[model samples]
Target: MQNIGKIVVVAAATLSLAACGQGAKTQAAAPAGPPVPPSSAAPAPQSKGRECAADDIKTTGKFGEKPTITIPDDCDPPKKLITKDLSEGTGNGAKAGQKLQMNYHLVTWSNKQVLDSSFDSKPFELNLGAGEVIPGWDQGLAGIKQGGRRLLIIPPDLAYGQGGRGIEPNETLVFVTDAVSVPAG
Candidate 1:
């Protein structure tokens, strides 16, 4: 039993050292502590952002259902990505380097128009923090729990910087995302 304990400690130390060596380029484990209350538990890791301003946008729907989002024509967005949970979920929290599946509704901030949505079709699947998706999603979706619905307002720098195939130049994107699942190991 003593030898087993020593091996466990050594393995944990090695993992900690490896994680530290990777720096900010790699995501770290959540801080160890007592359970965080639901109200304060879902903020994305390392995001320098605040809660959503109520008047900045509006949505009508329950979690697990498609939401109707409205962005007033004169609404001005913040420079950084902001997240707000419409409903808190119970499950393992999302993290970087995991394969995540989400149901998302996307809108263009300037026109207040929906650009694309996965509600009517298949859920979108992507490896979190991978370049397969835009940086906004890579950063905004971290730490979300399975079944949680998050509202994300992504600035131009995080979305498509200038323009992409279907997005406008310097577009500030708005998304309502549901963390459908993260496959278990």
Candidate 2:
């Protein structure tokens, strides 16, 4: 009788432990999917494939001003543009001078594979035309409005050139950039 009582207690304890382990596993797996949006019940769809020239990109907003030039046909078409308001500051609209803070998404021109992105965390800050960035950035950003979103299609000459930068040597580059903020004078 004593031995049987001990066996039953041990069995119950083992089952309790197994239940706890399963609970822990369920908790661990719950957060792996896409994060739930606060306002919407459904998660936003993740982008797939290369964001190509034919793709319709959209700009939802802008910070400062809008450019007047017609969107070049040769240039990659933007998904959207923020046309609601225009504001101004001390920074030059196109010239690269002080450091600019931007959120950028880069992809290979050939494959449209995303090479890097700074959308989730924070905007990237870099000095324009200071050789700190690729030649395409220095030149392509020349006439862009300060608070605008622009798509840059960079030929090899303006990008990695012959030697290429990492996997991008001599390859054409494509970038979608949001000029989030430029330093005020």
Candidate 3:
């Protein structure tokens, strides 16, 4: 019985030492430097745009139906023109290759909170005819005269599609925009 007890203790000790050695080897083999920060390993920034949150979207109506949009009172009203009515743009005013400057605020249709804007100081410029922006911008900005302010309710199909870049997928976008300038031909 004494010998058997001694053998059990020896086996336990050997197993413990083996575990300890492996643990030490693992510790030694691990990188000695400080842990890398998560930010350092993050994916590179993409320029498509930020995505919207899923909670920000609301599609109660049937597909292909344009949602109703209400412009806030603080939004500047559309202007009137003598030679041309600037209130509602002609929808054919802008052509490809022409640069346009405009102040815009984008919000979610469900909450009406401003998700993005370029209206703080200077207006944002874009080639109207080019396909540089979302389809809504290209189609919505077409034919709109300069100095006009319009409200555009862009559906997901026109705005971001299923997965909106930088925002949520299939989100409807609302924009109040003032067309500040349009380059002449």
Candidate 4:
């Protein structure tokens, strides 16, 4: 056993019981304490963002169901991404550079049609700021605790911009997500 501060590393010999050899475990055994080189410690994750201020965008419907979005006529989305946590989670908060799994639903600003949904498939895995997803999702979901439900309103710049993936040009996107896990740093 190794101790750093109050942490204890309970090192044990892991045995392979299967005939077929497995390559390796994805997750590493966490160190008993902080990194030996304190300078190498990862920076803390950004806290959950503030609630949306765009009065034009409104949501009406229960969670875990197809959400209904109401967009006021001639209304524009906020320049910055707006985020709101509908329900608190029960897991740890994530840090920068860490990967996470989430279930999400996305819709266009003009028409409230669901462009994509993870509810029909598996949870989407992404590393924070790793450029696997849109900037809004990366910035908005940062530091979000696991199992938490959050809503994000992303502007065109943060979304697809002039050329959208499946929607119109310069379209703003709305996302509702469930942060399933936020591993310890």
Q: Compose the digit string of candidate 4's lDDT tens values, residues 1-185.
A: 33653342222223333212343332245445323436774454233343336555676544455455665544455667888887777666666699998888888865667888887888889998888888888888987888777888998888887655786666778888888667866
Q: Using Cα atoms with residue i matched to residue i, what is each candidate's TM-score against the true structure?
A: 0.68, 0.49, 0.51, 0.63
| Superposed Cα deviation of residue 98, candidate 4 (Å) | 1.1
Candidate 1 residue-wise lDDT at 28: 43
RMSD of each: 19.1, 13.0, 14.1, 20.8
Q: Model 4, residue 161: displacement in angstroms?
A: 1.0
- As a TM-score, model 2 comes out at 0.49
Candidate 1, residue 109: how far the Cα is off, in Å: 0.7
So what's the TM-score on candidate 4? 0.63
Write model 1 residue lDDT over 112-178, tens digit each, in one string.
Answer: 7889989999789999988889999999998888888999889989999877868866678899999
| Residue pair clashes in candidate 2 | 57-79, 57-80, 58-79, 58-80, 59-80, 164-169
Residue range 1-185, candidate 3, lDDT tens digits? 99999999999999999999999999988997644447756453243343332222332222122223343433222211111222654234667778998777677644456677766556888998688887778877777667666556676777676554565554567766667786554
Report the lDDT tens digits of candidate 2 across residue range 1-185.
Answer: 99999999999999999999999999988877544447854443344543334233223334422222222223442332222112332345756676778777676644446667677568888788898887778776654555667766666676666544454344555566777875554
lDDT of each: 0.81, 0.58, 0.60, 0.70
State model 4's lDDT: 0.70
CA RMSD (A), model 4: 20.8
Better structure of 1 and 4 per lDDT: 1
